[model samples]
Target: MSAIPQERRLVTAVPGPKSQELQSRRTASVAGGVGSVLPVFAAKADGGIVEDVDGNRFIDFGSGIAVTTVGASAEAVVRRASAQLADFTHTCFMVTPYEGYVAVAEALAELTPGDHAKKSALFNSGAEAVENAVKIARSYTKRQAVVVFDHGYHGRTNLTMALTSKNMPYKHGFGPFAPEVYRVPVAYGYRWPTGPDNCGPEAAEQAIDHIAKQIGAENVAAIIIEPVLGEGGFIEPAKGFLPAIAQYAKDNGIVFVADEIQSGFCRTGQWFACEDEGIVPDLITTAKGIAGGLPLSAVTGRAEIMDAAHGGGLGGTYGGNPVACAGALGAIETMKELDLNARAKRIEAVMKPRLAAMQEKFEAIGDVRGRGAMLAVELVKDRTTKEPDPQATAKVAKACHEAGLLVLTTGTYSNVVRFLPPLVIGEDLLNDGLDVLEEAFAAL
Candidate 1:
């Protein structure tokens, strides 16, 4: 067998001349005010390095929005997906059924936390999985209200928009969101309502009580949350908060749904962030890295609750496509064999210190938070006031991108820089990315 590629060779400046030209073309080709984080147009990728059209190679820390934990263009994943494509591309699970789909479901059932009999339904995106989870919860609990947390990001779908906490980009003009969705406060300690470092489980309990009193516990079908909030600055809820919420949901018959779409697949040092608290959610939604880079998602949960929906209620036209399922099976196998969970911890080991160093030097870095490979740094104008520094954050991110490191920014206030490097990234390349970040901070 050929050896694994291990080099990050750059032959041109990032977003080289060709990439800039292509970006110009993209502006007219794409619609809906589509935005791009990095300007480089990928021509090829292996391991942790991505090569653009102009042959400029750079370290990837965003991992395609956290979808390539195994690394971009993994050998096993590509081999399996290509071989499956040769056999047959589509045999939609709902229409013709396929073994690959069943195989993927079985893997998810075993991987997701919970020894209780669990079932999984596949979909094309995280939003679809989340939307379906809501449907299943309502069907099982016979309730109408759905509760969400502040700074949480579910998806861009109408229902998910209603569930998402951000308003400007996600909910802007997208009005008349699905009804019965309500928002609650998350345990964001750094920007705590009372004061810095003042939020914890008690605040979460208060939010829960408010929801119960205003919306009525009996009417609530589910309460969805990210064990480690992703787009919301990689916030990890205060200790005990997740467990308390899980218990409350159990007592009230409100399905506890963990939105692990960005936090799953060992991104948070555990296969699922919910596992960190030892809390088994009634429903768990996952996507992104599950199928390597393939567009595949799943909603796994208690078998009884999952089965509550009718036969035709849980399927989509392209849900669980055979090709994507094959890719997922291969990706899962690779993750187990390579021990990606350990890899995530390794990434955290390297990043936490480097970021802490940056925080020590940069007064704008108000907070550095996250569990593992999924991490973020929140920018603020002043430590005392904690006013978001969106402009400065954007400047640093742009500089990093131009200097050969692809990064992503996310937050309710657009002042957070999230790092989701592929767990398979090499030590040297990872360090180089961090060095670029340091340079960006200096530039800012």
Candidate 2:
């Protein structure tokens, strides 16, 4: 897939002179609101590594927040995109329809969870796809209320901001979110007050009861969830939780939407995360890794539900750009050719054992959970109380960055260090990144 030296080579102090200069320039030119996990600027990125501006190379543990599953410079993705670029960049799919768009939609229908007759609508990002899913659901049911879970993250748009659960960075000070959005409890096993064993059915029953008592199921339009919660940490809800919710959605005629922006593709060791639980969502919103780093998203759903939207009701200016569609086709091809689902499982097989060993040595690591290439360790001050240790999490991430490894921090409480390495990463490189992680914990 790549010829780039799959090694971590630090030629200078991390965030070295060139990167420091770029950061200064960025401060002046870019908005303060825009943030970065690492301050060093990327010079070039390939398979498993990123060479920063200072000539230092880093093992990429975060795949641009789980976007580049086929790697940054996958040959198939590049070839397809370059071919499309020469053919046509943009005529706007809405203006003059293209085969690439139809091809991408067809691919999604085949790949997404269900076998029932499916249709798709492409968009530019995950948020747009999610917002459109809500539109389709509401149009179909003539209902408005949308239900989401505790650790769920939809996006940053007004309605999605309401769907998202975080406060400080995402929703705070941004007053006046969209209405008709309700929040329910997520089956976070580690944080469940009762216990991990009871989290699944108990949390599901609690959520179902709340909806029935307060926001009557009959009035709800959609119930959106992430099979593996992303931004609110990689919390895989207790096993039976999703099935219960999906059944409730069915019984109440609520359109169940699976937001698979981060966990879609092969990141979760399956074509889609919901398949592990056998819960077929009525509609699924996908982006991020779907197009091998290109900005392409889609809402794929049952034909009857998708057709509810009128012809003019959906679509945007650059909803499915030709080049992006080609990139998606290439990405899907790479997924199939490489058998990335097995690769993802292999990554988990390699990573979980190493991560478990680290936890055995460090009490700060309270929990290690996730599936496939998407994995994380939740930091806490005490194993008993399980109080989040955000300071320790920050220090560990900073240490990894300083040592020429790129890692990311996420969680509702900001105490989880998430790893989303590229599936094509060499074993030696992945282990090297994990070695740095172990060292960071030792230093703490």
Candidate 3:
């Protein structure tokens, strides 16, 4: 059915001659700050395979950072997007409203957690969605301070950088970040000072106390968090942690915003990870996987809160582009038709046990965490110390790349090897990628 074969086939070494040539050109023209996990330049991608410029096809474990849940070139996505491209590319939603934009908003309302009347505003990226969510929350509450947790990565923008806890590449040189952003401890189960059982209640109590004491609860606008922390080692908050936090926010009138950018759209075995704990956020930000591969993000929330912003207060020139909206419609269609949420669960069923086995064999594997297709392995120097082994993590990722399996590494400590295969990926390809990972760990 697909043009590209769903198998791993390496015609040349990773980053072959053609890719090398492109890399040279990229270096000369592109900004140095723009980094890439893999050096190979992709020419064609379908299903779970990314065929590079040199004709080497690598099994895609990283779904372009979880943006292509249905696959790179899904049938519905291509068909709808192609049809929309021929019809009309852009008119700008703010200038001239489109049916596709409204359709996407309606879909999000039905899909995202909560039965209450919901509304949505589209943007071009996760960062923009998050920024706008913050704007809406502040407007609704008439508050200034916004609370975030440690290891939470909202985005790369100035305001998000301040909200983010990590300081390395994200916030290193980007100083003088926006004010009124406060950081609190997250219930990272692996690194929790107390045992995992107590992590949920203890961390929530501490976080709430900090907000109340350090920053008055009345002054706080939003308590935003990732249902499952992405770019922070795929950390899922301890059980009961999210519920407690959400309840606190509800009681205090603080807007609970779920940043479901990476974990939304069946990537975590559900439509959104927040559904796992039954936490109904006041405002939820979505992107990355919303529009197949096109750039589209949205802030979906209770209608009352969303309407807090004045007329023409929220919008961008390129937000909700017609083509991207079409892709989103197609992607959502494919998800339902194919039952991608079940597929994500199946992926987890296949990956978790294997990763657990690897953990038993490899001492470097500190922990294996994450949900459904969004899984990761945290590498450490020693089991007792749990000192992050970023060097070993790098080696494992390199080995996977060399073996024709595309994987990604993420974490605040840079010691997490994350796997985000397309939900449409075949079981054979998934097993083969895991085989490559096992071999990589064995070699290490």
Q: For this target, which candidate reaches the highest lDDT against the unseen true structure?
A: 3
List model 2 lDDT by residue over 173-234, tens digit each. Answer: 99699999999888999999999999999999999988998899988999999999999999
lDDT tens digits by residue: candidate 1, 335-424:
888899999999999999999999999999999989889989999999989999999999999988778888999998899999999888
lDDT of 2 at 20: 92
What TM-score number comes out for model 3?
0.99
TM-score of model 1 (CA atoms): 0.97
lDDT to native, each model: 0.88, 0.94, 0.95
Residues 25-80, candidate 3, lDDT per residue (tens digit)?
99999999999999999999999999999999999999999999999999999999
Which candidate, 1 or 2, would have the higher TM-score against the true structure? 2
- Model 1's alpha-carbon lDDT is 0.88
Q: Residue 403's C-alpha lDDT in candidate 2?
A: 93
- Candidate 1's error at 364, in angstroms? 1.1
Query: Can you tell me which runs of candidate 2 are displaced by over 4 Å?
Result: none
Which pairs clash in model 3? none
Listed in order, each prediction's TM-score against the native is 0.97, 0.99, 0.99
